[model samples]
Target: MTTFDGLPPLRDVIQTHGLVAKKSLGQNFLLDLNLTSKIARLAGDLTKCDVLEVGPGPGGLTRGLLAEGARKVLAVEKDSRAMGPLSEISDVYPGRLEVINADALDINPLEQLTAPVRIVSNLPYNVGTELLIRWLTPPTWPPYWASLTLMFQREVANRIVAKPGNKTYGRLAILSQWRTTPRLVLELPPEAFSPPPKVHSAVVHFEALEKPRFEADAKVLERIVAAGFNQRRKMLRASLKGVKPEIEDDLRAAGIKPTDRAEQVSLEGWCALAREIAKT
Candidate 1:
């Protein structure tokens, strides 16, 4: 049977291209076009925006994004096996799809796409968090993408949107919330993929903020957060030893109690401390 877009089923696409899930590449092909389209829709109206996709194995999510009215799609695939299938998608969509045969980690996708882009993908598990951090901390304000709709392991998704005092909250939570408003949009059981992963997956939507939620030097903020969470069990005075000898006074000036532990402090509190440190 044909899919909604009249293309052959994804399993056929995978088999035709000899695309097997490569554990080394962190591949788990999603055969369900319906689920892929749902992920596409979560990116909202794609009629006017370019979509950036990472790890489009057998072009499952690529097909969905094109069919759902993406003005253009720039799909980066590392595994050469999936290129044949993605090439087929490029033909189906004509000028609307551009397949880049390169590692997602090696390429700067923002440099290739037009402005007002939205990244939508089922990211490769091994590098998903690293990619998210790159996007969240691009060197300049008003980042290349307008929003991000990406899938990750359930645990990673929780960390991205976690709030203060939540067990999942940590470096990811601080980095994500500092620059964007992230939401948990969809949850999929392990069975959603061809070879079911041991952990469930989730899709997250992150809309970039026009202005950062707080003001601090990005480098300083990272340093402060890393110090605080690296030794989360310790008091600020002890945990921030790497920061400066006067770090305790700095924390106090930021209105964060010196006695508070890392997890107990809010994102704003971290930013406040970062701002103080930057002044030193």
Candidate 2:
């Protein structure tokens, strides 16, 4: 009845706790220990790092993180039903796992986790992108976590690592690549989850850079990127005309063609444009 980690198999835990995946909260539990453990391993050398796990339904990935030697795990679960099962995990791990029965979106996990942290989660689909943006654009540079190993829908994963000229490229791509090295590490079929989601999912690993890849004002860069992609089909000169009094001039000054569309511009090009626009 027990798995290699000495914890009961996730199904047994779910059954014992009467856990049911709630679609409204974006819960889709990964029942396979080996798969979850593999995901934990992808985070790399967790022995010294405190890990943050969101929505630890039935503690599948939670157990993975502990078994793989994470120094400690702060698991934030929104569903009250999960607290009981997760507490059981906390009992087994003995001070290694801390479960917070609150929405991951509301609280600052850094308050509970220690230094040299890494965030590893099979993020609930609903708030995954929003949480990623919050992490990507924290108030200061070199935010708490040194790395992020997260799971998202395949479409989103592609967008995170998408390159200029790819249809998937947009604000998300710019933000992800601007200050971090993001790569698609693994892919999963829908059947992997307890109540399979409608789409395939993938894991992405992001290592934070000491500084942004290029020098540009963060606020200005975000404004430019958002405006540029808001009307991605229009030429930069037209799409960004409202951004400033003379955006075409700024675009040319940045070495960007006035006729180029948003998807045609690289991250460096966007930085250049942001820098140029900031001058006016």
Candidate 3:
């Protein structure tokens, strides 16, 4: 039994099930139960929350979430080989764990998750950024999850909680901060994983706000932000010129200078610009 959850130790489980982290699937299994539990704790109280976890490779974090008293966990695992190890976890946790063998991007987690959902995952590197974008850009406010606790490559993690004028600041920071309060909670070295990815990893915890921090049309905001950051080195006048015919006027109205670069604009300023551009 493992000390963290009283299930088998992860290394034993891995050897028993022949669970090798598949590079093709972007798998670098985090085998430390203690660390996984710590990551789960970062999600706050999970006793009543349904956790939606993606890429539960070998079920390390799955066990942690269950042990941490998550009301229920909907674990989406694309690798079928992991089902054996995951099944053993489900048996231990009983009804609290549900395993879905499918691509997380292909399925809608809301269909399986109950309200007050907390999305917690040691996300696969290949799909982490894409998944975060999808979660942040959902059609309506508050989307489906109450909070998001996800691990990403350190570089990507920095982008999530970055602020204006930072080199990492851009679309991710703006989009993340516009709707949720994101904080970088923990950092892990490469040695923390089974395969040990070359780069370090970090966990980001995001608490969803009832409403966007600032009001703006989602589509308009997305469009202009994309344009500005797509050519981040260029001044807004040059980069966002294609977004709206009267780009300079809109920038001024938003209290931003047309000469400002994308990274120079604050979230509030970007939202203001989105609103200004939407008026046209």
Better of 1 and 2 by lDDT: 2
- lDDT (tens digit, per residue) of candidate 2 on 130-168: 999999998899888999999999999999999999999
How accurate locally, in lDDT, is each candidate?
Answer: 0.90, 0.93, 0.93
Error of 3 at 65 (Å): 0.6
Error of 1 at 91 (Å): 1.4
In model 1, pairs of residues that clash are none
Q: Name the lDDT value of residue 210 in candidate 1.
A: 90
Score candidate 3 by lDDT. Answer: 0.93
Per-residue alpha-carbon lDDT of model 3 for 132-153, expressed as tens digits?
9999989888788989999999
Runs in model 3 with CA error above 4 Å? none
What's the TM-score of every candidate structure? 0.98, 0.98, 0.98
| Model 2 misplaced regions, further than 4 Å | none
Model 3's TM-score against the true structure: 0.98
Q: How would you encode candidate 1's per-residue C-alpha lDDT over 1-280 as one tens digit per residue?
A: 9678778899888777788898898888888999999999999999999999999989889999999999999999998887788887888888999889999888877667997799999999999999999999888977889999999999999998988888788999999999999999999999999889999999999999998899989999998898888998899899998889988899899999999899889999999999888886
Q: After superposition, how far is residue 247 of candidate 3 from its true place, in Å?
A: 0.9
